[model samples]
Target: MAMGKVPGDSEGGDEVGFAEINITPLTDIFLVLLIIFMVTSSVIVQQAPSGGAQTGLKVNLPKGGATDVTARATDMSVAILSDGRFVLGGNIVTEDELKRAFNDAQQKDPDTIVIVQADEGVPHGTVVQVMELAKGAGLGQLAIGVREPQ
Candidate 1:
């Protein structure tokens, strides 16, 4: 068999455009996947909620995984939900309002540790944001409340 001899070599468009690997299918699949990826990425990014209402539990997680059960949830803990709802010491606050609240909390107690308790449904990054806020407010340490793996 020759290289470009598919029924009609120079007559029809099929022979002229035909590739040995039939790249058209591959191209189509790649394009579809690209579109799917773009759409999915946007959706995933959009699903990250931003709000304020401290509902999640608060606890002083032991640093470096020590058996220090003496850690307590002082007045410096923010619990966030999947919908951006955050609760700071039983008080509801918006994401924007958290800064001032954290500042006040830090003032009251310089040794304050911001404990973050995010819902299991919340994205991992969202929880990080909560911790960052605590640090930004000049708190000593940020603690995330996590249940022992069962």
Candidate 2:
């Protein structure tokens, strides 16, 4: 019996040795792959788009239609139904009440944005009227909401 090699009777004039598993090469490959994945993930994270304002001119209309305009959400959402009923955050509200709500929201933050989500069947004039109210409240960051195309 040898210290490293398995004991084999010296018969039939044949020479054979036991094979041992090595871990050093496998560990080295694993470390290299891990570093590559970490660096690639960081680069992907940095390249993603940031949360920022998007601006674009509405397309295919004479600036009066709302079909192509995009409407984004704000921290404050106001809804106007087809029946001229107004609601703020799902609660029924009168025009004066809505104005007061806007006043309160404005007092909290000057840069507060307002979103108007109205029914498509509602008259454009009605939506404009709501916009006028928002303007009077000194809320310039206005966004009109629309349903996405199916």
Candidate 3:
């Protein structure tokens, strides 16, 4: 049989090269993935509660517009949860541990600033008590954490 000719064919058809690429399926897959990603992202955004409070305990912090400042490496944080628990750098700590942490920080830098974040539900006296402990640990600088009123 001649090249490009059927078994009983007298005339041969024009030669055909490679077959055309089929992009429709690829395009469909890409579009489906894009839609899935878009839907998931939107759901995540919607499911997350706003107001910038992202902690294990719900803390309705007092709203105030204090001076906006960047946190320093030497700066320390003390959070007072609504349940009267103390959190240092996101970890729950006992009063003794809190005192030790402050002492360690003070040993490294005498002027270490202690930022106090107390929940609105927390009693004022407890916040003051933490501040007193920070002072006893030789920390000289102290700042309170408050969210900007919305």
TM, every model? 0.50, 0.51, 0.55
- The 10-residue segment with the lowest total lDDT in model 2: 47-56
lDDT tens digits, residue span 1-150, model 2: 213433565454545454666789999999999999998776545422345443233235356664553433435788999898998977999999988888887787767778889987899998888888878988877887767679
Q: Which stretches of candidate 2 lie over 4 Å from their true place?
A: 1-74
Q: How close is candidate 3 to the true structure, as a TM-score?
A: 0.55
lDDT to native, each model:
0.73, 0.75, 0.84
Segments in model 1 whose C-alpha atoms lie over 4 Å from true places: 1-64, 68-73
Off by over 4 Å in 3: 1-66
Q: Is candidate 1 or candidate 3 better by TM-score?
A: 3
Q: Using lDDT as the measure, which candidate wins? A: 3
Q: By lDDT, highest first, what's the ranking?
A: 3, 2, 1
The alpha-carbon deviation from the true structure for residue 95 of candidate 3, after best TM-score superposition, in angstroms, is: 0.1
- Relative to the true structure, candidate 2 reaches a TM of 0.51
